[model samples]
Target chain A: MPIHEKSLIRPENIIRHESMNLQGVDVSGDWSTFIGSRTITDYNEDMQDEIAALPGGEYIHRCWQCGSCTNTCTVNAIEARFNPRYWIYLIRIGLEEELLRDKDILWQCVSCNKCTYTCPRDVVPEGVMKATAHWLELKGHTPDSPSTIFDREFSNQIFATGKVEEGRVLRRFFASTGQALRQPWLESMVIGLVSRLPVKMLLRLGLSAVLRPKTRKWSKSRAAITDYLQQQGRAERRALHLSAGEGTHV
Target chain B: MTHKEPTGDYNGFGPGWKATGLTPAEARRATDWVEAKIDRRALLVNKDRVEDIRERMWELEKDGEIVVHRIGDQHEPVVARTLYGWEKKIPTNSLWHHKSCGQCGNIPGYPSSILWLMNKFGIRYLDETDQTSCTAWNYHGSGIGNVVSLAAIFLRNFHQAYVSAQAQGLPVGTYYPLVHCGTSFGNYKEMRIYLMHSAELREQVRKILGKLGRLVDGKLLIPEEIVHYSEWLHVMRHRIREHQVVDCGNLRATIHPACHVYKMVPEDVIYDDTVMDGNRVAVSTGLMQTLGAQVIDYSTWYDCCGFGFRHIIGEREFTRSFAIDRKIKVAVDEARSDVMIGHDTGCITTLDKNQWIGRAVDKVYELPVMADCQFAALACGAHPYKLAQLHWHASPFETLLEKLGIDWQQAKAEFESYLKDVADGRFETLYDPKRAITSGPGFVRQQGDQAA
Candidate 1:
């Protein structure tokens, strides 16, 4: 019941024979080869619609599979899997299982809009990629991306005060994203800057940090914008099938 | 929307009626000038609004009695009437200066350079504290800001410009709304189109602003057209060259036309290849060409510097990689550029800061990246370290300055000693970097060789 000599080797393209006598020739260099096949079973059919429901993703249906977006993508040249065309195909056909394989890298779209500029059909693949990233977080597939955290803090300052003070935004962004304030590159940039800046200018910059930059008489406009954004948030949530008040205050 | 005179009611005056001293005739004239200044096609919803407005502007010019300055295309050469019987689109009188958060915060040299050139040209500009940052950065970066808030801010800044001009006894449109940032220039253009295109958006914004006491004569006042400061530099390029104090003879300049300036509204972007004997393409390129620089064209001229808003702060990896791979690498390897002129702050910062990391990582290519105004300041003989502030930028320009026959080391040491004197209170507190040096370049060259 056992081929005794052949059992010594692992069946990974190996051939073994204790004794071989054939009528013509012993012609077995490779035998016992192992092959594997895969089947995709977890297709979530509503994937495209969910991404499209987010802002910047409404034009996903316009892609023509020309691969222009991927070819022109600034990130794609450096990374192999950051292909917008492949993801759009996986998305359009509801290959949710396949899409999840690239989950860790989906939010890395740099938003250069080169893809958007090159897309003949106006697919706006940069926007689609952003929306896709937003969808991933909303659906609990990934945690808040560093980009999301940075954008949230930046937007918050603008909402509170009609202007964004650069120093304030940088500090808050670094804090929220768990990054050190004294990053080597950032410190180097500041050192170069302050080395040449006059003392009066330094005093002025320090004053802006203490006083903070803002628009005059921004109360009414700020209140209106807050209401409008809240309404937009509720609507976005409704489309995603989540509770209206599920997330933290944006 | 029809252009009808305000018959008997004066209801059209809205909140503007509160201005105490104006008689009926004076008010009517002001209203007519305001209405006449507007590009009617800008207010109308249409597929071909830009060209349509241009065509209609010609028709109005033919029929009307006032020999008015055409509101848009102020940067084009044809507006100057072939150099005689002209209006200075680049204003020589005092104009209000709108500050940019990005310019003032990230690249302090940008504003200072413009001020230096203005002093050189005898052009007067006012930096007003009553103005505010345009706030377009947040709106475009994240979609958190609604149309209403942006509209309110736009109205607020332009209204301040108009009111200040009037207080100085100049017309409402006299100061010309010189936008300092490319993003604000483009964002305001987009908002203008949106405000004209959607009645619902406009009414919502109007109501919101009216409550905040921003409605002028009960109407949102839109500027004739937004003019970027880079455009002003382009218009005066010839004057700058003929009067140039320093010769940038051996330099080659390549321009990175900030995407926000060229790509946002492609049709409205100034200059064409055919405009200057198949040479001029953008304001930066045009101005550089006029300065006798050997301007080079590279393959990645159209690529963004990867400022990508949040990508700079959050995705530092992509920002740095793209800055080197897409932009600086092409400029250095392909064009062999001496200096790169970028119009926007983010693009300049992205290019200027990331080159150090590029060298650190063994990706070794180099070029000094700076604002177009900074280059203009340098060419007009502003002090390299003090006024041009090359010491603050990451991309070193000492080699380029040495090529221009200016002593970079001496400039640095002199400025350093100046700082020490100020620290010791041995010199005057008010230091002016743009004060002209009496010695010629040859004399400076001799002094530089001796110092070295």
Candidate 2:
């Protein structure tokens, strides 16, 4: 008889013959199936340590595989493959090749923090997911995602002026992400507001767009933050065994 | 099929028959037991095992490592209980308005409603433009920023709040910070814990703050409590209800509690036994109940509004889908809510702005979304167009207004005539605009700028 829960085994690792004879008994295809030995040799042993070097990845080692994060994950409900628990397990075991399979959707973490909130062991799975996504981009596994582009656009404004004007951020983000400013839903939303908003409010919004809101005497704070982030970026690159100035834009 | 012969007690079943499977009734009981185990109240009770970071903050304060921006008698604080029954003193007066960038830029009504309500109560506040956005939205959306950057921003903004009163000839700490954005509320709380725990982090931010001259007595200034505007509305709900003119007893309201407000620092969020039996965070719900509105419950109360900082910008389809399906649809279909109330800037924007797009996919659930303060302001007889600024909202609030016995057409005409005054530069403001430029280049010293 076939082994119970045989589906758990990888189909690629299960060998089946069309027909076979076991001694005197003519055991057909059903009885001729055999389980193949499974072995892993391409483990990137430094995967866990490299991820741990990132900001959010610090507590990844604390995950005890209780699967609570995946169970309560917001993204997991929408996309079942966006599993934080499974990814953390793959990361902890140094299965870099296995992790690469889900690289595209890793950055899709909504940061709802439901995973971090429910994590029994305080693994902070949300942070781990972010670190892994960052690791992917740094190692050239993928290019900068649209989310990264938006974050950079938003953060650059704060680092420069200590405040963000939403209009400026939205326009710049759409531009950097190579998306048009004129999406159907976006146009409808703007029209809906414009139809009712007072002219003064509209003009004020227009004025803000012209002269972006900024914190006064923000030069010192901006300089300090730039210096700190650059230093942190250099340190993170070194931890990942990359040369200085690699992925500098990130 | 062959029928099994009846046995003594087993009835043809093997040993441990009870363990093999559950009957329908037994299965239901098991499901209920599991549900009860994971209920929010049970989860909150289990949270007691975690160390309270506030205890450590007090230790650090006593050790002279940090300065606590206390809620003094002047601020008139009201004590409230949190998830784990922790005491949090919410100041009811003399508040420093830490405005939200998203609210001001996206939904003008949000902050206006807040300021308008405070005016009705004659609450002392400083509506200034000196503070910066918490920048947590950027950090959470992108993996670029570290904890150090967030900590420095937190201290810088709170330091401004601490000393902002000095500009008005009042003593320092006169105005305790009242955070306007839910994201800022959550981010500041988390940053406070991080700053207290890591001496190294505090040292790093202290240097940055020192350079900016934001340090108080050469030490970082930390607030005793990070209070959200919703909490302020919650504590003052009864007083606000006394001024209520519109009867919302017929309104069915569903609250979209910001995840950042309660979930981030779950222990710090208010939970009253009177509100939803304390099973849910009580800020928005408490106010709605106090206003005599029927606060309805829905299944997806705990889900995020999909304002996933990145999801809203980069993967908008996911945001729209989640907002429409999980939030708006559930509130409309399950609760038949007249309106969806939210406390966070992003939640309001996402839920309100995304509803119009739902029609593209034939999923048109036209539910109006507004901040709790805006709704409260409307109930208290604030002009829907002038004061509450409902015109700035994307969702169709006309139906909601009509149902509440408000004349949108008259309000619109009045606002249109008011706009002519605005166009000619005759504008009305909640506070003196000169006070907005506290320390900026355009700052003009008031005549009575002397310490009282």
DockQ list for all candidates: 0.01, 0.01
What range of 10 consecutive residues in model 1 chain A has the weakest lDDT sum?
A28-37
For model 2, residues A1-250, the per-residue Cα lDDT tens digits are 4444556766665555556554365645434344443546577778899999999999999988999999999999999999999999999999987788889999999999998999989988999998999999998898988888899899999999999999999999999888899999999999998999999999999999999999999999999999999888998998899988566344
Number of the top candidate by lDDT?
Answer: 2
**Cα lDDT, model 1, residue A231:** 90
Candidate lDDT values, in order: 0.71, 0.86
Error of 1 at B296 (Å): 0.5
Evaluate residue B73 in candidate 1 and report its C-alpha lDDT on the 0 to 100 scale.
Answer: 32
For candidate 1 chain B, which ten residues in a row score worst on lDDT?
B78-87
B198-221: candidate 1 lDDT, tens digit per residue:
667778877876786656666666
Total clashes for model 1: 1
lDDT of 2 by residue, B16-65 (tens): 23443566699799879867765355443534355568788788889988
What is the Cα-based lDDT of residue B181 in candidate 2?
Answer: 91
State each model's C-alpha RMSD to the native: 31.2, 32.5
